[model samples]
Target: MWDDWARTAQPLKGKVAIVTGAGRGCGRAIAQGLAAAGASVCCAARSKSEIAETVALIEEEGGVAMAFAADVTDLQSVTAMTHATIAAYSGLDLMVLSHGVALAVGPVETTDPVDWQRTIDVNLIGSYYCIRTAVAPMKARGAGKIIVVGSGQGHNGTASTSAYAASKAGTWALTRSVAAELIGYNISVNELLPGNVRTQLYEDTFGQVISATPAGGEPISSKRSHEWLKAPEDIVPLALFMACQPDIGPTAQSFSLMRRV
Candidate 1:
């Protein structure tokens, strides 16, 4: 059944997909993957230069993509991005909220207030804006896929990551609420909780912790762990599957992609 689904499930072909934070990291990978799967992707981010690079890479590989510069934290920018995508593609079929920030090494009480607010604004509020802005076009079409890029920390508590962990947890809960509200419209809303992905974000945040901690003290071991720490490419197939598969059936569910060591 799964093979048959995969074979016949190029439903995303010629469909429009919007991927935020597509400048780099997992977001860029997801955007590229969607485009490769035959979706016309809107690659959005704060940096035009980085988004342009992503678009160039996609076009070089013969995939369709367009770069839109927008800060996900800004509602005006989010609205502009949605409008631009609609103008370019007529309508949106998929919205992937892949952009997020984290300050993982700080203790809750000692964490910088600026970082805390930024994390909440970027991870929680930003996702809401994307979903909220995309809903009208999706409702008009009466169908769409919304994928929230969540984190394993949302499922389980991780020390020294109070703000990031809280924001992701909120994202998961928000996804559930949106899923309930949109199911009648045939919009499948889901969350993907990635574990220890080797993205720039992961490297910047956890890499320091990994480097400082002793071999045995490492949260995710450095040795015999490379195979388990998912690559950005590893995540793309699942995202594509969730977005393209018909009859996703349930709403308000979350899936984890971590391999236990």
Candidate 2:
């Protein structure tokens, strides 16, 4: 089954993609997956070294990719990245907004105002910037796909995660709004929930939560942590599925890999 799926998932042969936050975690994984599926991918991120590593890995696999340093919070930077991708590959078909931060992971009252705004800027507004820039190129192609990497916490807030949750919730709302606007243009906008993948952001945010609990009341243990965590590669199939969908495929929707309680 796996072999068959892999063989058939190569429909993106001549497509082009831009993956934000491609330096590591979900962004890097999806960038690699898209390239393996035959799309020329642009690995965009703030970390020059990290994105370079991602590009190297993709090239080593006989895939086409380029590293672009971009700050999603800056509209000009995002626009430059989009233009560069189009200039390099001729067109853009897919964009995966996987860049985010968890800096304001403490009590709401104590959360730094600047940090909260920065979180909103990177996670929510940054998404808007990418979406805005990709619109023209996608419209030029007459079809496109935009995938927003979101979280379950956006649906129901968790304590000490107010800023992060708020930003994601805004992203979810933004996804739907954009999807509706692009319906006639054949542009599919959607959200993808990657669940509890063990990335650095996860370690810093959740680790802080676990350590703050009272003695004998730990919400997560070392052993349980492993069980709950998942590898970034696990998201590849679902992402490929969404990216490979038809022009008239589902939009203003969310595809989740998270388990229910």
Candidate 3:
């Protein structure tokens, strides 16, 4: 059954997608997934070098993609990136909010004020700016898809990571609100809460913490017999499913990816 769906699910052909934070990590995976499904992807990120690399990879694989550098936390930069995507693609069918920063793990009482502010600025405020800038074009076209990359921590609580968790929780709410408001215009909005994907960002932060502890002492992976962690590629299929099947009735919801028990 799933094989049949995959063979027939090329619904996004000729569509245009904008993936923020596409320089690396899960963003790169999402961009490539969309491109593989026949969408022209606009890869947006703060680092021009990494974004270019992502674009190059996509093009090498016979996919259509272009790189654009923008600081999503800055409103003007977000606007410029959106406009550039529209000008190039002539239309925008999808917007994926995947840009975020994860500060060092620390208790709420000990976290620096600046770091907390930066978390909110990039994770929450930046997502809002991207969605706001993309809405105008999507509304004009009367159809679109918006997927916000949230975290499992957002649904529950994780010790010593209040800022990241809170930012992601806000993203969940933002997704719900946008879905409620945009459904009238035929735009679908949703949130994807990834459990633990092996991306550069995840490896740099959580990998170090996990490595320092013994197998039995690790938080999430402590009980797992297999030491392997899921990769960004594993999460991209669900993202592509959501993006291409926007007409599905699962808007305003959050889905998590985790190994089966």
Candidate 4:
């Protein structure tokens, strides 16, 4: 099983990583996975209690980690967080921009301006801040890996998800741009589409679990197959694989687990 493999692998030993949105869902899963791979991880998020739980879980598994409360929307907060991670682990080598929001889930014409803007603030701008702050440390170290947890919505259009789509699309573009800019510094930046995992964000936004359909049958969602619904743990392996890649590994590319309908 995957658990057995994780226990035996130490490919990332001595590396230090920072995972945003480490409170729960895919972010928490990735953080735990990185720890299991022998990296010192910093579980960062606005929810102190939630990140504490993540750090506790990592500690319970005998992995090195710490919980840091940080608001990604604020540049100063993100900067302090990056500094703290470096201070704790002596340096930074990996950054995972996994925090996101999908508050504007209605027709654009009828959506609240505040909610729409907030969605962008949290998902797109927050990612920019995290990347901007983390880049300095990584550049200083001469090598780093940045993984952006993107969405299927970014690749194609979908109804009632205008803001979320725009933000993720922007993030995808940003990932490519940053990767190109950091290539000379030996940093690799890539995006990971985790499919439609059954996280709290999914329940709150869709209120329905994506169900499996018969062979060759239509799915519930047109953008992706309903059967793509997965547990957070299902994403860990791909994340670990990307994290374990060489310094010259693929960058500006997207690794997706979601199937198109």
- TM-score of each candidate structure, all chains considered together: 0.89, 0.93, 0.89, 0.93
- What would the per-residue lDDT of candidate 3 be over residues 1-261, giving only the tens digit for each residue? 322343357567888999998988899988988887788999999899999999999898778999999998899999998899989989898999999887745656667889888988999999999999988899888788999999876776456567888988899999999999988888899998767777777867575445444344437454434434677777787887788665645789787675535
lDDT (Cα) of model 1: 0.83
TM-score: model 3 vs. ground truth? 0.89
What is the descending lDDT order? Answer: 2, 4, 1, 3
Q: Name the weakest run of 10 consecutive residues (lDDT summed) in model 4.
A: 207-216
Clashes of each: 0, 0, 0, 0
lDDT of 2 by residue, 37-134 (tens): 88999999999999999999999988899999999999999999999999999999999999999876677777789999999999999999999999
Candidate 1: tens digits of C-alpha lDDT, residues 49-145: 9999999998997778899999888899999999999999899999999999886356556667988899999999999999999989998877898
The candidate that wins on TM-score is 4
TM-score of 1: 0.89
Q: Is candidate 2 or candidate 3 better by lDDT?
A: 2
Candidate 4 C-alpha lDDT tens digits along 1-261:
666687797888999999999999999999999999899999999999999999999999999999999999999999999999999999999999999988867666768899999999999999999999988889899899999999878887466678888999999999999999999998999999987899989887764213322335443365453557899999998999999889988999999987755
Clashing pairs in 2: none
Which regions in candidate 2 have their CA more than 4 angstroms from the true location?
Answer: 1-9, 212-228
**In angstroms, how far off is 114's CA in candidate 4?**
0.4
Off by over 4 Å in 1: 1-10, 208-227
TM-score of 4: 0.93
